[model samples]
Target: MKFLKIGDRNLLYPIIQGGMGVGISLSSLAAHVAGNGGMGIISTAQIGFREDDFYKNPIVANLRAIKTELQKARDLAAKVFENSKLTAKFLDILKNYTPFIGFNIMVATNKYADYVIEAVKAGADIIISGAGLPIELPELVEKGMAVSGNEKRTCIAPIVSSRKSAKVILKMWDRKYKTTADAVVIEGPLAGGHLGFSYDELNELGADTMTSRNYKKDKYDAEIKEIIEEVRIYEEKFGKKIPVFVAGGIYTKEDIAHVMDLGADGVQMGTRFVTTYECDAPDDYKQTYIDAKEEDIVITKSPVGMPGRAIRNDFMDRLKSGPIPIRHCHNCLALSVCDRKTIPYCITDALCSAANSDESHALLFCGSNAYRADKLEHVEDIMLELTEDMN
Candidate 1:
């Protein structure tokens, strides 16, 4: 397969394993993908929820775990190389030319910029910020890099949903920070978790949140094409190629090929990876996807004031009935004041429960094609299947 170059780093496989948070994608999944030549991203959303003192002090726990997770990915990658029968020359090439570890920090998180700064200082090779337009991302990266005292460039990318968003971010960064993005992830409305589109827009496409499934190709494809074209304009301005990756509903080799045909440099997939053996989520959590049906995947309201796609379950049914009580603030979002009274439920607690495999009570987030997952498979096998035709 042809390689993808993001800044100074050359990825052997153009695919990026999307970051799933709470406790879904961690060192095990990220390291395995990186070891196999794909960019692996560890999600920083509630990353420290597993720490013993997390409830007492969530920020400190998340910061400490961020450093620990990145280091663990590096350690695991080194072990993979040392134990392999591949020649040292090729191993050395990989070690020098590629970055195996990265962090996924949502722009909507509590102390969003702080997380980016801390993650960079903790040795993240790349920072993928999403869930909102990361306008100040470039400035934070500049400061973070300076603090790290590392001469090497740490790649910064933003996850965008529309051409307007892409243009706005690129223009702002160029005018203010005098910098351009290293990469861009174009996420469509069909993506799992919090969607980029509003409820009305999503409904206008006949997206039956309760039952029928549909993919409005014309609407999404046009947006993606426009964004890619906008990126090309910046590429010409900077006299450098900036890679664009398409995400959302990408489940098979055909899906990847289709997007590449649309001028995408690569793809970022999160849901497919969740059912992999290496995914950090509990077995029952993986089982949720495997057991789901087309009708089970529904559009729901996120506590963060955004719409999300999730599996229809008893917990969700109860939430629909009335607002569930918020026992304590999880300190998940970067807001001056959290209006728990207005929100339906606590996202952090729900996701954490899902990660722990609490099927009856947890909110199960999934991709549009999650119902297609029949069983758990190895990360290596999934990667090969996705890239077999490309190679």
Candidate 2:
């Protein structure tokens, strides 16, 4: 294994735990990953859903929880490395790294700028945004950094699907904002939750139209390779090394080695982490993945206006009748265009229910490889299996 360096921080392992939202990956899972030598990501998606006022004042609740979760992660990191001599060189470097904590803020969220600023102000080490093209991300992050007054600029990475999106974002950032991405995550269609590809593209690749299945990594590698090539162009232009990490369908040790050979600096696994003991989701939710059969995982058009992968269940079955009315708005997204008449269901409600383990009436989002998990395990054990030397 090698180091994945972003900004002033160098992760001991080239692994980034994918930020599963709706309270799935929070302080607990993030702290453990960072403590064990990888970048720990906290999903800022409805993070405050548990707060007393979350239903009434989601923005306030989310902002407050951001501070709490970040502090918790920092505290955990401090306790883990407190004068501990795991190794002479390792301990010395760990003292300086900022716990490798990051925040995943979706680009499509309502008050997107507010989320970015708040996360940065709360001392997030990295800010990753996806779900839509984050064209203004550079400017947003720059403003946040200025407000933060932190000497070191927080690292910013965008999740992109192809070389085209990467080129557009890097060019816009460099020419318009005089900034570039610190890194880029290439998330393929096989990823859990929401996907980045068009419905047509997914179908043409032999995946089911409504639920993506039978998707293969080899089909996406060429695209990833081209994206790496495009990223290198900006790397030379900005005179910085922008590491590329591939996400989706990454499950085994061989999977990690495959991406590394294809020029990825690391691999980010979401579904692989969902079954971990430290994952923030309820036990029943974890068991949902374990119990899923290959045929049960399907893709659906999410209320958020994107194609998402999830385990098929009764709640999803209800959608077949027609668009479900939105009873309450959790204010999950910043946009005001959403309407109950047109959308499928209340995304906030469904996700929150799933997070709270009410799976029968909730959307059970999963990666294409989710059904592969057959048992519960510790994050430590999972990480060990993925990184163990096959030689």
Top lDDT hit: 1
lDDT of 2 by residue, 324-366 (tens): 7788877777565355557778898899889997877799999
Reference-based lDDT, each prediction: 0.84, 0.82
Per-model TM against the reference: 0.95, 0.94
Clashes of 1: 0
**Candidate 2 deviant stretches above 4 angstroms:** 80-89, 92-95, 209-213
| RMSD to native, candidate 2 | 2.4
lDDT of 1 by residue, 137-160 (tens): 888877888999877667889899
